[model samples]
Target: MHSEHPPLFLKIAAWGGVIFLHFPLVIIALYAFNTEDAAFSFPPKGFTLHWFSVAAGRSDILDAVMLSVKVAALATALALVLGTLAAAALWRREFFGKNAISLLLLLPIALPGIITGIALLTAFKTLNFEPGFLTIVVGHATFCVVVVFNNVIARFRRTAYSLVEASMDLGADGWQTFRHVILPNLSTALLAGGMLAYALSFDEIIVTTFTAGHERTLPLWLLNQLGRPRDVPVTNVVALLVMLVTMIPILGAWWLTRDGEMVAGGGK
Candidate 1:
């Protein structure tokens, strides 16, 4: 038996698309080590770690980094619980509002992020909610939940319900059935989803714009650093650092979800 793949031209086009998408990030990584302080001059004159040290010394950048970490952690934690619950409910039941509920859960990820951000901003304004760290976490969680929900729901669909039934029949209550059978089956999905949620929350800018009041994330801080000539090298260093840190969780999620195979291995 032979595995089939897309046509050569289509494959080339797909790879081309990826290259086009990632080229800027590659360029940024390259320029980050450039010894020259001038504006992104290509084929940099030299390379050094001076800029990395400079980035470390910047007080505001450190604060922004800390703020981003806190927001992403909170958002990821909230997304894990809500997304998993939503996924479980959607997977286990058929009801009158099923489609609508599913659509609403997915809307944040499916819609243009700018639109979601704007709508969330408007809703918050209407509710007279102050923009702050909490607001940022809520904004991020709204979308982050979608990421986790999709992953967990897909895994839940693939899992065998008989195992859960067996557990329940063996004098295990619902919570016990979940703890042993269902939760173990969902471990990989939950891990992958949390990683995805963290990644999304870390770099999100549009929603953060609406929700972040007097709070700067790393991305926002980078935006601010754009205007300063002397800070250029340090900004590059920080950008590269952010890219590396952000890429880890994103790649981990991709690895876990690659084949969509629900890991049957139960936790110890």
Candidate 2:
């Protein structure tokens, strides 16, 4: 016989971990509404929406937000295309250097962000590529591709190859089969991967710092605000916005993929 429930201590430990990770976020949210701007205090002075209005009127915040959104969108798009193609090529195929290729694909994301950022910065300098918007997109796409590739390839492994064969046997052309059969089966995985990739890119600071030159994405702007203590309330508001933007997509991705093993046309 085995226990069906975790021990009480284990449950307590789990909840403790959750609180430790998220208590700071709760504090950030509380501070976003704090009326006192000088320094963060316990229990918060009082609640007001003044900071939200202040953030709204700031052109720099708006510009940073817009840049972050644009970079995230473009990076996700690039990741979806490249990652899907890579997964399709590798899913049921065995060839020379396949494992090596897979390892290379995952290396960017597996390494530390600072390492990846440094490597990208060095490569750009070698190639005489200016550090700016395009570099930022490329840098972001490198890791974003890994997120999409993992999601899609996992789905591919679960999916039956016979679906493609059956479509062909039913007089469907390659494009038609892919459009009608494959796309539907891949829809959730692709969407989840895209959302995850977008969220990752949107909040990324290290790689963007190395590649952005003078460009300020939302994360960079928030980082710069650290030096301006007077902007604490506005910074809190922006931080809350960033958290919401990243967290929502992450939650959406989790919801989309929670039942992923039961994907359409899966199994033998």
Candidate 3:
């Protein structure tokens, strides 16, 4: 039996839309090797490792990359802990204002990025807190938690209660049950959550702007590159590098969460 699909026009339109969306990225990746001066000429005049070498020795770019990695790692770890706890609490029992709590958890992701950035800035000003690596981590974690929370909550909802109860019946204490059983069950969700957190932190610029007073991350570095046209192709190289750095975690998370099968033997 043949299953009905979208019309030919719709299929073409879908592919067209994808191409329109990603054409610039393709260009950026291709021009990374162009040895020509500042201009990004198609069919690049000559291929060279100048920019790649430049990116390697550039201390500022290296520092930004290091900062970005630190922020993403910290944010992901913090979000994993907080989000997992929140999910566990919600899964354990029903409570008053559950919907409100859940909505609040989701607000950071739902609201405009500018709004979140501004809000973080305002809060930091009110607290008289200095914007730096710490601020960046906090800012990223605020949203990262939601990514983790969403994944864990969905996983918990589908989880069988019998498993936890069985662990308890086998004389497992709360911490032991969680460490051995619950944590294992949530391993995949936690992994997915952390990856999402890392990816989100990697590309985040608006919030970083509010939180970063002096130190620059890779995204901020890229933003600064925009003012100088001479470094345009160099920017493309850094952009490609940035994309690769962020892409791995998101892809890993997608693969892990897509099936949710890995979580089956989690706690044991």
- Number of the top candidate by lDDT? 2
lDDT of 2 by residue, 114-231 (tens): 9999999999999999999999999999999999998899888878999999999999999999999888988999999999999999999999999999899999999999999889
lDDT of 1 at 162: 84
Query: How displaced is residue 226 in candidate 3, in Å?
Result: 0.7
Model 2 regions more than 4 Å off: 36-39, 262-268
Report lDDT (CA) for all predictions. Answer: 0.86, 0.92, 0.87
Off by over 4 Å in 3: 37-39, 260-268
lDDT string, candidate 3, 1-268, tens digits: 6759978999999999999998988888879988757346767787777888888988888889999999999999999989988888888888899889999999998898889989998999899998888999999999999999988987887879898999999999989988897788778888888888899998899889888999899999999998998888778899998888788998898789776643322343
Ranking by TM-score: 2, 3, 1
As for candidate 3, its clashing pairs are: none
TM-score for each predicted model, relative to the true structure? 0.91, 0.95, 0.93
Deviation of model 1 at 50, angstroms: 0.5
In terms of TM-score, the best-performing candidate is 2
Question: Model 1 over residues 48-162: C-alpha lDDT tens digits?
Answer: 7777777788788889999999999999999999999999999888899998999999888778878988888888889998888899999999999998888888899898888
lDDT (C-alpha) at residue 126 in model 3: 96
TM accuracy, model 3: 0.93
